[model samples]
Target: MLNRCIATDAGSFATQYWGRQPLLSPSGSLPRDFSDLLSGPMVDELIAERGVRAPFIRMASHGDLLARDCYLGPAGFGAEMPDQVDSAKVLAQFAAGATIVLQGLHRLWPPLIDFVREMVADIGHPAQANAYITPPTSRGFDPHYDVHDVFVLQVQGEKRWLVHEPVHQDPLTTQPWTDHRAAITERVREDAAIDRVLAPGDSLYLPRGWIHSAEALDNTSIHLTIGVAPLTVLDVVHAVVDTLATVGEFRTSLPMGIDPTDRGSMAAIATKVMAEVTDTVQHRATDISEGSATRLSQRHAQRTRPVAVRPLESLAAAEHAGFHPVEWRRGLVAHVDHHADRVVLRLPDRTITFPALCSPALDALHHGLVADATSLPGLDQDDAAVLIRRLLREAVVIPAKQPEHPTRTSRG
Candidate 1:
């Protein structure tokens, strides 16, 4: 997926461009255009027929985001749900030069959902998709930077993009472009680092904190922004700090009457505390590292979701689990831990336990083996069937017939 979005191979992107600089792949550089992921008609379907509501659908004109009421109203009659997109209102706004933004398309649209899931795995980061549709000769956003990295894929028509170097490089989620608005506004006044017109099949990659903005050309333009949020070293430090809660020394109360408001006294205390923490962390490095890795994995799992599962189909499959093959849920983050008498399957949301006898089956599934009851190890056929059935119902495994790759269809 990453290779498809860039003209260069994945290795070149990682070493030279990832989180460092911007790369613009000229039109026709990539293998194919992004119409397979999204298109102009798909945008209309979302607004007019998908029952899209606020947030999922929004509009921006010139440089400001319009109010929700401008394009959304009740669904009318049976639905009667306020905040659903009113197609008439959307058309009026679009005709008036407002850019329609389809947010979280990775969740709303099937193609994008599968595309983003694969892209996330390829990039080792959490990713999201949003479509920007702008009228001719208009800009939707002001010159600003995003805290997360983005890949802009031109789907239709053309748009001119101007990108300047970052005023603050590698900004965290808590650090937004607004915090450096003054610097960003000043930076854009100089010659841009990149000034190019992106047509269908073109792609651009921008690291976080790079100031950029785009304007539609003579025709309406549609594009997808795949935002990737990478985990930083600070995340690891935080997990290690959290582990301090298990140490009594770190949990003890601060010096009494510490004059909390006094800068001088607080500085002294901070110095002493820092030294103790640094020493403790170094001495117990191995344990802290192991714990921190688990914490980080849990954090990542919580942020991402497994591939979509079909409840009805899964239930039906569970009823006949002994015959067909099953594989671990694609993209599910799970860790299997064995104990004396039980095996624990830790998921992002919760943990599931099973008798120790089921350890072999769970281990095999966790390692990505597709199997039926007869193929499962360490368990009788009947017991393996029961285990498979339970896992199917729990959404831990899905039938092998389901494809994990994105289909060519734009709509699911």
Candidate 2:
């Protein structure tokens, strides 16, 4: 929830906790139900069913061959599992992977998915939210920092984090640089100033560029890392470059033949091109913001059709209590309100506006939690069908429960 923290003016947590100067808002607070979102048995099932995979380092054991390292060992159930079994297993898995990069929420265990959805909705950037879990006694990644800002939540067990001040002030640049592995390693060895253990319910905020590493404590640990994607000057530059590609001057090559003595003419042409590029870049931020909002508003499941049975008319009337519909995709959340005759969905890209009339139908089709058209009071069969078709076309309604009959529908 990048904007949530920004909106609440709590974006300065990095400065408050890590002694860095404040740059963004510092008003928002972590959700109180953060722990309840991840600690449970459903998580345990994911751990037990998963397998381990890691990179191999060369060893001199038998004729310069690579040996299999047992970082977290084979993924298996613990005999004396912690009370919060699922969270522990997820954390253990994360540690085992060393540097797990999660994308879509569909890859996450069901319980975690639910928790993430709620949190993203509350934070006001539901469409731009995602979570990553790590395993115990393992380090999935080498000591490194991220390009995006992150909020780390310790749901179960404990994890030890070693933090180092950022050496590169502007880390998230479009122009690539050589990996800073050697420098980071040297810095960590020199002075380990920020080292702390993150226990259950504990939270850490790491801005983009600050280097850090994590390892599980004695017990297995499960933690959720909520990453926020920020807009930057580089992003604007990229958009401007992309837009400039359509211009005739950008498409045409420079006049190289008539150059040497006509340097003044060529310079004037170059200046004109530069002016256009600069103007585009200057206005690119607004375009990026709108694009972001559009992405947020339109994000939803990719279901082709609704699966759950629509509620009966009597039951629909009895259970018509207004419930906010929340969706989580790619670590972002979208909150849907059925009142005010409008539906507002937010994401990292932008906020989308839709008619409130479509909220119930959209939620029913996307989440698969509420009943379908049959139960909805105002929606008729045709109306539900149209809405479902529209959402599917927009890539918002994803498949929910599989159809019982294999031949019932055509696959996308």
Candidate 3:
């Protein structure tokens, strides 16, 4: 339950935030204890139960004169593994001095998934979100900046950060190592704008393209880095070209004259076609932003099949009639099918359909309004028997009365 303090001084804060000059956030603590949120017991459980992968982490070299001490893999290995390390030892190393931890956040336990969801919301993007935790000893990453913006939250313990101002103002992309290494070199020579320490509950916001490094300062330091997905002009252009390729006009060859020396004319035709492609791509961004928008665009676990329904025990008189209940559980999306003759419903992630009339029964059971078909309204013996059979087949409804207890219990 990390508490976040958004910048209150909008005027001054906005002026200094993520601009050419570096800035530090006003120190604040999180609302909840991180230990309680991610207890040690839970950490062990995650490692034991969940098939967690540990990707190779990287570190920056001080100079060519020194040898690189590779860990887990090669200098730039990003392999995945399933193993738990000493949390205290990693924290101590960060406290000693280490920068960056690759694939650190993706290894988080399930308890932290909610926190990751909220952080993605704060970034104002619907992209899939993940986090990396850097203990004191381990540098999860190298002394490099990320291509996308990041929201760093100190969940527990303490960490120090050194932020370097952008050398190339408003770069097309951050983490210039992939494209603009020359620009990164120039910026590093210019000098860092801010250096500060962050303790538990403190958060630091770094816009994409800014250079920065961090190290743990406490015995156990845990932090969450929320990454923002970047949408580039090239991406838009590519998308537009792909869409236009369906048109015959785009596939047709340009009007090339028979004269072999008319190369200049061919160049002009190519330029005009490229311009059209670029324009279409620019407009297509709006469609990509709206039509495909998801709450959390990141990949998630595959949805499980709906629960099976059980027969109603109260409808003993009507052997032919059965009832089954299907619930639209919270945090899940589903659809209902209500026809004049039959009732059916479908889940967003599954194709399973249930009787539409069963919707009310599911609601009643989910809300604890009825113990079983005995408490349902207008559900006669025959209807109850049919509903029970359907629910049990779909796994959407369960027995209200367990064998251990002869009497009916509250429906859940």
- RMSDs, each prediction? 3.6, 11.3, 9.6
TM-score of each: 0.95, 0.52, 0.54
lDDT of 2 by residue, 1-412 (tens): 3333232334444335323422322223554335555553534443344332232111111112222332224334663322222334335434444433333432344544544454444433322234334444655555777766666766677788887876665477441223676777777786765678876666676766777777776776666666655445565555456655655656886666666568898788879889876776576657645554444344332211112222342233223222212111122234554568787654334556676777765554434333333443357756655544444333343322433221222211
Q: What is the lDDT of residue 109 in candidate 1?
A: 98
**Cα error, candidate 3, residue 312 (Å):** 20
Name the runs in model 2 displaced over 4 angstroms: 1-35, 39-43, 49-106, 117-140, 173-178, 258-272, 279-412
TM-score of 2: 0.52
What stretches of model 3 exceed 4 Å from their correct place?
Answer: 1-5, 8-24, 27-51, 56-108, 121-142, 168-178, 218-220, 232-238, 254-267, 274-412
lDDT of 3 at 162: 75
Q: Per-residue lDDT for 1-412 in model 3, tens only? A: 1134343454554456633343445554424345544443454454334433344233232211111222221212353332333344334443545432433333244444455544433433323334344444544444566666676766666777777776544455433644766666667666566677777656677777677776656454666665655455554555445556655667887565545467887677668888876675576666544333221221111222122223443233223223322232222333455666555555454555445566665545445442334545446656655665554454444444333322333321
Give the candidates in order of TM-score, highest first. Answer: 1, 3, 2
Winning model by lDDT? 1
Q: How close is candidate 3 to the true structure, as a TM-score?
A: 0.54
